[model samples]
Target: MEKDLKEYITPPIMLIVVLLAISLMFIFPVLNMIILGAILAYGIRPIAFRIQSKLKFSSISILLAMIIVLIPLILLVAYISFIISGFLVGFFSSNPNLDMDSVISQLSTYIPQNPFLDKNSIVPTIQSAGKSVLTYLVGKLGSFANITLDLFILICSVYYFVKDGDNCYNFIKSFVPKEYNDFFERTVESVEDVLKSIFYGHFLTSVIIGIFGAIGYSLLGYPYGIFLGVITGILQLIPIFGPWPIYWALAIMDAIGGNYPRVIVVLLFGFFLSLIDMYIRPAISSHHADIHPLILLIGFLSGPLVYGIVGFIVGPLILGITYAILDSFRKELQESK
Candidate 1:
């Protein structure tokens, strides 16, 4: 036992462990960003390689690939922010002397009156809730510097991961026992499939659905249709939430405003959106690994709570990859037996 302990846990190993612990302490704050970067790199690598073949320069290819993948994402976020701010500014500016009672009375016109329910009382509650939500969002936005730093780190991490992913994989492979080399290779392939499965099944589906939503809403003559579509797409990414919420909310608003015809139209459009997802998701995901919906559901629901917004991407991918590895391990065990 003493000899085994000395052989396995020598001074050098102890020193390495101490160094790793210290390194983790520094990275713990931005670990989520780093993980997200690596995942993004996996998606970007093929694009980088394709670009490299044409550009004949590895660095330029990687940078261009990053831009290709990331620019739309950055623009989407910026556009969403712009729309939200613009809407708020327009609403308040246009209604400088906004009358709460008048608004309530207008709403009450389309709403069925109930003697027990006081519509007037709900106005204060709604105002308080809106204020609280706005304050929370503003407080989050106040951490601009930290957000910038994390983004910088994420970009750097992605660049290196895409550029040197092979080296990283080889380094990790070196640590695996020769007997487990086949297992490691199989696991790697499985993980790749998992990544593909999630990217195509979830993200791509959301994008398609969002496009459908944008066109439908615009055709329906809804203001800010693009923003509504974008929100619908984001909601589609979460298992518990889907295009239903957006259409349902719109329907409710239209109903209250006495636009009953538009409400029915939007509801039908939303149902079409949902129905296509049943076909689109399976078609895109069928070629790759099959990850359980439950795993993704847990990841999507729990990821944001732990890692903030990026968790939406990181959570499901991480869980899917973990599942792949475990499944690979099980196969290896069965083969051995």
Candidate 2:
């Protein structure tokens, strides 16, 4: 009896062990990149296929489609870098004093005169805190090499994912059961739709908002108005809180510079730009995919947490595919029962 029990349990335990070992070997890092690559490929493959049909050559079509997608992204990044460099140079070269001594003097005088007065020690503490913040910023900016390498890795990874996307998807899908091929195909379609909605919808909304923002800022005579507008539009891709911070920062800067009329104009411009999210995102996403906005919102919020920045695209595709597969399986189970 003991021997039989042992024999009965051994194979199943071994199987479990083997599966766990295999998963540990290939799962973590590759999983995120593979998922990201698959969604990107799925979105762009149709365009590549269309180009292929028109040009009657697969390689040329692939190349053209890739170039079309990559060129704008490259140009945008270059422009943003140029703007950032200029801003940094201007800021440091101005040599404007922050008036810390006057602030400390005011605090010391005002607090001592007030009924709430324990100002003796607080003044030194406040000065120390200010100096600590300055020291932190200086230390952070000193690590330029690390920052540059990280950025380079991000760009290269994105490029490689885009270039070899089809192969990546095919490799991952090979794991699905043969009997579940139909379900697998549908899941792939759903994932493709979700990714398309995210990528194209976000891109279209950003461009529209940027155009309106740039026009408004130019009219208001803001220096670097187009750059600020573009920055705001790009930041709109961040979920939960979008471009509000950028607009608010610009408004504050304008206010500090005594351009109150420009502040009002910028605020109104931002208000109009905010409406574009309502009009553009839903229009583009709904046209491509019939996904619930709540689901997309969940994807957008949870994505970065799970997969770093790439998760923003990967999260929704994963949720869509899981929903598709489970729905199909449930239907099948119901029919069988």
Candidate 3:
């Protein structure tokens, strides 16, 4: 045991370990971006290859692919921000003195009159809570430098990952024992499937649902219908939440206002949105492993806490890949036995 320790933890190994630890400390801050970049690279790689097949310039092909994938994402985020900012400005401007009484009175019939419930305080409480949330978001915007750095890292990481992802994979594979090579290959393949499953199944489904929502809401004559659809799409990305909240809120509000016809129409539209998700998600992910919704839920819920907004993507992917690795190991073990 002593000789094994001396051989394993030799001076050179110890030095490498110390340097690696310091390097990790530096990398820790931007780790989320790196992971996100890798995820994006996986999506972008096929496109890059297709472009490369035509253009025959690897670097240019990668840049074009990145542009194709990233531009829409940047635009979507910017549009969402613009819409939200406009909404806030309009809300504050139009309702300088928001009438809590009318809102409460409208809602009074639906809410059971409990002696302990303070009806008048409800709207104010909600307003205050909304303000706090706004403040938190604004505070997040204050970290411009960090956000910029992360963006830079993400772009660079994606570029390199697309350009040299195979090299990295082979480098890691080199460390695996010959006997376990098949296991390693299988695990990697499984991980790739998981990534594709989540991206296509969840993210794409959200986009489709969101678009449907925007069109339906706009035709239904709702204000900020596009914004509502965007929010509905984002909500669909999360497990245990779907497009229900948006329509339910709209339905309840319209019902309170005595627009019962429109309420029924919107509810039916919302149900259609939910029904499509049931179909779309499975159809897209059918070729891949059936990842449990619970795994995704925990990843979505906890990822933001650990890695910020990017965590929403990185968290679930990482967890899904981890699950793949574990399951792969289990299969390998069972086979050996």
Most lDDT-accurate candidate: 1
TM-score of 3: 0.87
lDDT of 2 by residue, 147-182 (tens): 575555544444456556667668978977898777
Q: How would you encode candidate 1's per-residue C-alpha lDDT over 1-337 as one tens digit per residue? A: 8998889998899999999999999999999999998999999999999999999999999999999998998999999999999999999999999997678657656666667657675666556777899999899799899999999999999999999999999999999999999999999999999999998888999999999999999999999999999999999999898899999999999999999999999999999999999999999999999999999999998898999988888888889999999999999999999
Which has the greatest TM-score?
1
C-alpha displacement of 96 in model 2, angstroms? 7.0
In candidate 2, the residue pairs with backbone N, CA or C atoms under 3 Å apart (3 or more residues apart, or in different chains) clash, namely none
- Which 10-residue window of candidate 2 scores lowest in summed lDDT? 150-159
lDDT of each: 0.92, 0.72, 0.91
- Candidate 3 local lDDT, 132-187, one digit each (tens): 99999898799888789889999999999999999999999998999989999999
TM-score of each: 0.89, 0.68, 0.87
Candidate 3: regions farther than 4 A off? 1-7, 92-138
* lDDT of candidate 1 at residue 159, scale 0 to 100: 98
Question: Worst 10-residue stretch by lDDT in candidate 1?
Answer: 117-126
Q: Kindly report which residue stretches of model 1 are placed more than 4 angstroms away from their true locations once superposed.
A: 1-6, 99-135
Tell me the RMSD of model 2 versus the true structure.
6.0
